[model samples]
Target: MNQKLNIAICSYRSATFGGGQGIFVFELSKALNHLGHHVDVISGPPYPKLENNIQLIKSPGLDLFSTFNFKERLKIFLGKKNKSSDDWYEFISALFGGFPELKTFGNRAKTLLDESSYDIVIDNQSLSYGMINIQKNLPLIEIIHHPITKDYQYDIQFSKGVIQKISKWRWFSFLKMQKKVSQNLKVISTPSHNSKNDIAKDFGVLEKNISVIPNGIDHASFTPILDIRRVPAQIITTASADVPLKGLDFTLYAVARLKEDFPQLKLVIIGASRPGGHTERLIKRLQIDQNILYRSNLTRHEIAVEYAKSNVAIVSSLYEGFGFPAGEAMSCAIPLIATDVASIPEITQSYAELIPAKNSNAIELAIRKIFASPETYQLRAEAGRTHIIQNFDWQKIAKLYEDLIYKTIDEFQC
Candidate 1:
């Protein structure tokens, strides 16, 4: 064990209930804290809910855009107090970038780093130039959840029209800045080998400069609920339906094709589609509305219950830097049917049934094949649970991170 040290973890979002990044920062910090280390999570709009004893440093964004309405908006504004120079810069970037809400994050980053003091500053994909300023004050380590370029390439390949392509291009314009930051920063960490290769190839960073730390799961929070019994033939997938990289729309397509043979086949999507949104329209067009279910705004507990009830869980992503859903489902002892996409195969390590992504026939066939062999589900489910526990559990991940952080700190001293 190492001496306890003051640490700061920063990210654009902190509401662990929302995305994987939030969940990562929240749980990882908590796990570190539990190990008798001092952890302070500095985050932006949609702030994280840390444990009562833990320190939560809120770096609020303007939140110019959100899925919520007036009352929720009021709460966000009313909750914020401090602002910083990075906030102003991020604001300018977002304004010019055409996504007004993004300005809030840019600004928050500037604000948080402008007056930084910590033993180590671990940035959770808040790859703003503001971080460069923090590096000037103390050792800074970045956790690139995955390379953003994969998402960009996936978008360019699957986009429907010129306008969509252009919009995605603008959204990803920040990656250039991120890549530059990575080159300058000495210490970096990513979740999986898939990400390690992508970072090296796309960002031009050396493999030695980056550390590999698997994403951790909270066995207590995500443990199975006794009542969530295995439904005879049910499947669950997570992510925004509009994103082609998620490849969930293809999963739904496979479901529609399989429904004729297995009328009771149910595909539960743990995310919603926008009206006139890519996913909603796809579902409407495919005419599988009756067999599919959509859920969003679920707490980790609720999601675990949903996972516990399903016969199998699927990761329909075309690319994953590190597959959180796949890992989480495996933690819950659910049989996984994941695609042979970026980094996913690395995480699953042949413990899962892998299929090629974007192929509806293959996805449908895999799902049906699993249905045909009920005995394999329990065996695979048990194997996945054991695998995740041994490898990706938070305690093990935290220890690895602790080693990397101290190593980076020592090197900086030299």
Candidate 2:
């Protein structure tokens, strides 16, 4: 048996239900600890909930996202007993419509790393200058799930107008820092080959230096519930509704079309929509408001139950690095329909019903076909479950990570 290593995982922010990155930090830390390693997660605001054994060292930031009102923020800035440079930078940048969380969080994380000792540092896509600074002090392995450049491209492509395009560009300006930091890292790990290719192209990193380690499904939490009754015509998808890249608008259009034939159809979104936001407006414009339901802040068990109850699950993203929703739905034995975008095909393989992205007609047709032949689709769904259990178990993924960590350490020493 290899000696257990002292590992530190750093993230700008982590929340159990926040998004993929947070879930990645939480799950990976737990998995590493389960493998007999001592894992410490260093994170900023929206701290991740970890298991008892795993230690969490809170590296607090301005937590500007938590302060919803401008008045509250103003009060903090005006009354200065004493404040860190990071606090002021975060408040100012965000007030001016720039994302400074990664930069500020990285500075704080670097300070923490300087005072702490770890055999290796695993950065969860902070992709900031501080990551580069930390590399000079300790061997660092970055987990770049996918390039933020793709996200910028998608946002720019889908912007509503010229003003929106400029805003999106300004907000994603951190991509410049990320690209520079990514290029200097000694080792980079990605969740899929598609991500590896995207990172190489978008960040200008050599493909040879990027390693592929697919994310795992928590089978224990995401498994099929035999006793739960499936809701007829219930469709489920997980995405941040306001983000255009998520392709929820296309899914909404498809559901509106499907209601003409299947009036009972219900689309359940496992995410929140801002009041008067684009998604909310689209829902009203399509007049499918009554048929759609948004459920946010769900526990893992609740998410699994949503998957088990649904007739079919959808991954409508224009692109995904790993497509966790698709994997989780498959783990719950639900038939999946996903767009053939980025890494969706890689994750779903032939198990899911593949459709062209940004095409509501294709999505509608896929849903109709699945409904027409329930028996056949159910078998395919079962095959997907088997696939996830065999290939995407977290234990298997952790072992892969363990080997990667050891290899990275050995190479750094030499």
Candidate 3:
């Protein structure tokens, strides 16, 4: 066993219900702690729900996105004592429609981390200038879960007009800082080969400097419930309906097309759709409102049960650094149909029925094939469960991280 080292993990925002980053931080910290390391998660607003043993150090910034009320934001911004320049910069930048949380969080994180003693600092995708400064002073390993440039590209591709494209560009303006900061980092980590390559291309980082350590799934929580009978013609997918990058719109279109053959077909989305949003309008336009259900704020057990009740799971992401929903579905032993996009293929291996992304016809055909041969698909689903248990389990993942951390510390000391 390696020497037990104190570790600090930094995240800009880590709301468990928020998105992939939050879940990653929460789960990874838990696994690291289970391996006998003393881990502390330092995060900004919308703090992560960590286990009792893990310490959480709050380093909040402006938290502009927390509320829409301008007056409330002003009060919080002005009323806070000993506010750093980073706080003012975050508020002012966000006030003008730029995402500055990464920079602000990085600035605050450097000061907080400098005061603490740790073997290594793990920056969980908060690619900011301050991270570069911290790396110069400490042993730092940055996780770049694919570059934000991909999101910007997808948004630009899906924009309705020139004005919307410009708006999208402005909202993602922080990519410039991320790209610049990433270049100087000594060591970087990513979840998949796809992400590693994308990061190299988009962030201009050397491929040799990046390490691939796949994320793990909690098999105990996501395993299949034997008592639940699978509902025929029911499909499950996790997505943010309003986000074009999630490809929920494509999934909705595919579900509409599938209804022509299987009229009893229903799609259950494990995510929320914004009221009066693009997804809401599309659901109305397709007339598939009656055939679909949206669910959110579900516990892991509840999500596993949802998987147990469904006949098929779909990952409709246009791109993913690592698809958590796909992994969760596989852990539950559900037949998965995922698009051959980004890291889905790398994660699912040969277990899933692959389809081309952004193509409704391909999605429809794949679903029809699965329904036609339920027994075969069921066997494949079981294989998926086995694959996850054998390869993507948290214990195995944590060991890999442990090895990497030890190796990094050794090389740094020499």
Over 4 Å off, model 2: 76-81
Clash counts per candidate, in order, are 5, 0, 0
- lDDT by residue (253-307, candidate 3, tens digit) is 8888889888899899998888898899999999998889888988889999899
Model 3 gets an lDDT of: 0.89
Q: lDDT per model, in order?
A: 0.78, 0.89, 0.89
Better of 1 and 3 by TM-score: 3
Q: How many backbone clashes does candidate 3 have?
A: 0
- RMSD to the native, candidate 2? 1.3
- For candidate 3, the 10 contiguous residues with the lowest summed lDDT are 60-69
lDDT of 1 by residue, 1-414 (tens): 278888888877766556687788778888889888888887776777787777887765666446345566556554646645544544455444444333345456556656755788888886666677777778889889887888889888888799878877887887877788788778889988888888989999988898888888777667667675678678898977687788887788888888888788888888766778878888888888888888888888889988987987889898888878988888888778899878898778877889988888888877877888968876877787788788888888888889998898888888
The TM-score of candidate 1 is 0.91
lDDT of 2 by residue, 29-140 (tens): 9999999999999998789988898888998676777776899877766665578888888888888778999998889999998978799999999898999989887888
**Winner by TM-score:** 2
Superior by TM-score: candidate 1 or candidate 2: 2
Q: Per-candidate TM vs. native?
A: 0.91, 0.97, 0.97
